[model samples]
Target: MNGNGTLIHLDNIYTAYEGAAFPVIRGITLSIRAGEYAIVGGPNGAGKTTLLESMNGMLRLTHGSATVCGLDVRRQGCEVRKRVGYVVQSFFFDPLTPFTTEQVVMMGRYGLLGCLRRPGEADYAAVDRAIRLLGLEDLRDRPIGTLSGGQQQKALIAQNLAKEPEILLLDEPFSNLDLCTRDFVSGVLKDLAKKGIAVVMVSHAFDGLPDGEIRIIVMRDGTLSLDETCRPDEVESRVRKASTVQ
Candidate 1:
């Protein structure tokens, strides 16, 4: 692929926890093109989560360089984050502090709106659209903490999409989801990819994805062990083999 299509570029990256004997990611280099659906797979302690965090500037790079949409992650983290959407595995909100689902979704737009400015009509419209798209109309006015796990996850996705980001990052989104919910969210992601939003996800279930072209990366011993672009069927076989070996 051409360099122009590259949205994420990592060259010789190294990251480690303080006082740790070894780096969590070592001499890693990879690039994700625009509109590509990619997944990172690894056994436990292989730095899959750390790699994702470093891409979004949640972790400081100990060595080498990372660029997202042509912006240096180390130097332009805030700017990079503005164009990127991140969905964590879990939501952490005070259960006692009541906030409506709609209100929680609106918070995504607040970062783009600035500290002093209040959300206007367009912002509210976007929030409503996100809620409707995620099928949260009935739960719109309900307290966020009262929703089920799947509903809460949908709310987080709605919040992420409200930012109108170019790249969406998801870490273990399907880990706690039921089979039906997992299929639903997977369909949503497929639609998002069709709309030309680049997606980079970390998941253990490689077989759950819909049939399409997908890029796969396998991590082992804190290093990139495999990187290939293949059809869904090819990816499944490859992933199965890799997982078995691990």
Candidate 2:
């Protein structure tokens, strides 16, 4: 709970997983404001994903404070999650899974609808807008599981958009996407940022970043090594310089 314009604020926080021996990240502090495009990069096991989860309130903090969208991450995790869209690192679906792309996207509205209530006109409108924004209109009725991995990834993003999140946390979202799709998705992210949606992404692929200033955060040994703003083209080099293993 700090900084009015800051969408995510973590102050001297320590996060650990269930039954873990010790904390994965410690004494962490960072602030991300709206309309910012941030790229988190580091060597493997450097707590990049952990930082994203911490911001999304998906992990338990053993110490310090984490606030997202003006709510306490520790005490108001559910509310925090509602305003933050988190696209995880890995996901796949069985080909026979029954839900269509549209149905899956509508699931984002479930949290807001509450118990025993169905999606109303406004909810459906939001879903439709999200689908169209992601260019998934052609795949709206297709079974989500039957789509290619890249298509499925795009659908996942559209699903999050349907929630109308103030901030988006994406972990290697382009891993399944090729160069062309990466460029298109990069444009989509840039547009979201321009519209005042904070985009925090963790990715090694840096060839398709947008043409603007990008905030680069680097992690090392579960600690923040660097935090700076540079041109989009400088992200990879800065990450390399800050990573411990490089």
Best by lDDT: 2
Collision pairs in model 2: none
Q: What C-alpha lDDT values do all the predictions have?
A: 0.83, 0.91
User: What overall lDDT, based on C-alpha atoms, would model 1 receive against the true structure?
Assistant: 0.83
Estimate, for each residue in 106-195, the C-alpha lDDT of model 2 and write its tens digit.
Answer: 988888888899899999999999999989999999999999999999999998999999999999999999888888899899999999
The residue pairs that clash in candidate 1, if any, are none
Error of 2 at 43 (Å): 1.0
Top candidate by TM-score = 2
Report the lDDT of model 1 for residue 93. 65
- Please give the lDDT score for candidate 2: 0.91
